[model samples]
Target chain A: AQSVAQPEDQVNVAEGNPLTVKCTYSVSGNPYLFWYVQYPNRGLQFLLKYITGDNLVKGSYGFEAEFNKSQTSFHLKKPSALVSDSALYFCAVTHGSSNTGKLIFGQGTTLQVKP
Target chain B: GAGVSQTPSNKVTEKGKYVELRCDPISGHTALYWYRQSLGQGPEFLIYFQGTGAADDSGLPNDRFFAVRPEGSVSTLKIQRTERGDSAVYLCASSFGPGWEQYFGPGTRLTVT
Candidate 1:
């Protein structure tokens, strides 16, 4: 089974400071990891994904994630936080070999950037 | 190109009523997915469709939940005997193929009283 875990329920960061939202996963095979953000009353927006490549993957809105295979973690990061960037973040994983495109998501983490 | 879209942005009904949510996948997208999200929780996978067939329906909670995609482009999720617990935002997403990044729809908020 493929599953993801977001350890934090909420994270608060000051504006212009770096922000990090933690995520870890467990899968039977190589994992395809993804990060998505959701704002009020809107659908989730894709941030980035780690299929197979460098350890670090950059995404939209100055966000990025580091895929640490050894740790089974893919934490989302932003160099500088913005008040508008506050939203709910979700981490998801799927088995690399699965053709169903079935994604198992983590309990979301709410990111709040305080100005 | 338009993104994945779902109809009935909001629906309110009494328990035991039948509800149907529709989804229109992006043009040429071969993969479609349905998920349910409750307040303060991440989205939970409900089913996946590949072309006109359901590739996986194991995520569905029970027999009361059913979906169909006869034409491989438009899909409909049917929930029979809707319960209060079924109140949630049902999201639809589509991708070019399996293992690709999925584009999500605005979701239909279903409120079962």
Candidate 2:
């Protein structure tokens, strides 16, 4: 079965500290990975995506993600955490095998950046 | 450029009532999708429309859920016999095409009492 997994329900980090939100996926074909952030009461905002090439992908708000093909992982990372960065993070995948554009998303991880 | 937009921001209805959620995709996007997000959970795919027809509807929970993108620009999600379990934030998204990242709307929060 194709799916995305966010092992941690919540990740807390102190301001100015580096942060990581882990994600792993299982899919049949070549995977197109994505990271999205959701602020309270707002729609999900696109962070970054990995279609092919370049293991490291940078996105909005200084967010970046590393795609590890061997581990089946696409973990979101940031050089430093900010109090404003606290929000819900989700990892999603859509493999090349399907023509439909629907994405399969993980349960989500709540990132809490403490001051 | 504007992003995807969804409306009525919130909806409250009793069981067995019907509801309609609207979505306006970004101009020139051909692929539209619908998803549902329960509290604390990520969005789950409901359907995908490539052009005016549904390219995929396997994710829809049951027959009670239906969606249409008749003109290929705007879409509507319709739910019949609204059950408490069906209450969720219905999200609409669109992309240039399949394999691209989808941009989401704020979503319509539905409550079935």
Candidate 3:
């Protein structure tokens, strides 16, 4: 079965510091990976996705993710973290072999940026 | 352009009641999807509609859940004999086509008592 794993339940960083949210996956065939952020009482917003091409994918709000084929991981990152960037982050993956359907998601990671 | 939208931003219902949640996909989008997110968890896929047909409904937990997209532009998710466990944030999303990135709506939060 296809699945995603976010190793950390929460990640804390100082404002203006760099931050990373780890994600790993297990799936048959190639995978289409995605990152999403959910603010309190808000819907999950799309951040970025790794379909094909360059391993490093850039997304909204100055966020980016590195997709490593060998390691089967897609990690979300930001060079500078702002307090507003703190939110619940989720990693999801769907089988690329098929139409991007039925995304398997991770438990989610809470990001905290202290000013 | 307008994004996908869901109706009844919040709903409170009693157990055994029947409910319907509506979703209007972005104009010209051909694929619409439904997901359920419980508190503290990521959204779980419920169903997917491509055009006017349901392409996938495997994610639906049981027979109590049903959905329709008669015109292919608007969709409705219907629940029968709803239970407290069914209470969750029902999310709707749409994409240009299969494999395309999905855009989400604010979702409808359903509370059962």
Could you arrange the candidates by lDDT from highest to lowest? Answer: 2, 1, 3
- For every candidate, how close is chain A to the native chain A in TM-score? 0.98, 0.98, 0.98
Alpha carbon lDDT of residue B32, candidate 2? 95
Query: Where does model 1 exceed 4 Å of error?
Result: none
User: Each candidate's fnat, in order?
Assistant: 0.75, 0.88, 0.54
What global local distance difference test value does model 1 have? 0.94
Candidate 3, residue A102: lDDT: 68
Question: Model 2: residues >4 Å from true position, as ranges?
Answer: none
Please report, in order, the local distance difference test score of every candidate based on alpha carbons. Answer: 0.94, 0.95, 0.93
Candidate 3, residues B1-113: lDDT per residue as tens digits?
Answer: 99889999999999999999999999999999999999878889999999999989999999999999999999999999999999999999999876678889999999989
The complex in candidate 1 yields a DockQ of 0.85
**lDDT for each residue of candidate 1 in B11-107, tens digit (9 for 90 to 100):** 9999999999999999999999999998888899999999999999998999999999999999999999999999999999999887899889999
Model 3 compared with the native: what TM-score? Answer: 0.98
Each candidate's number of clashing pairs is: 0, 0, 0
- For model 1, give the interface RMSD: 0.7
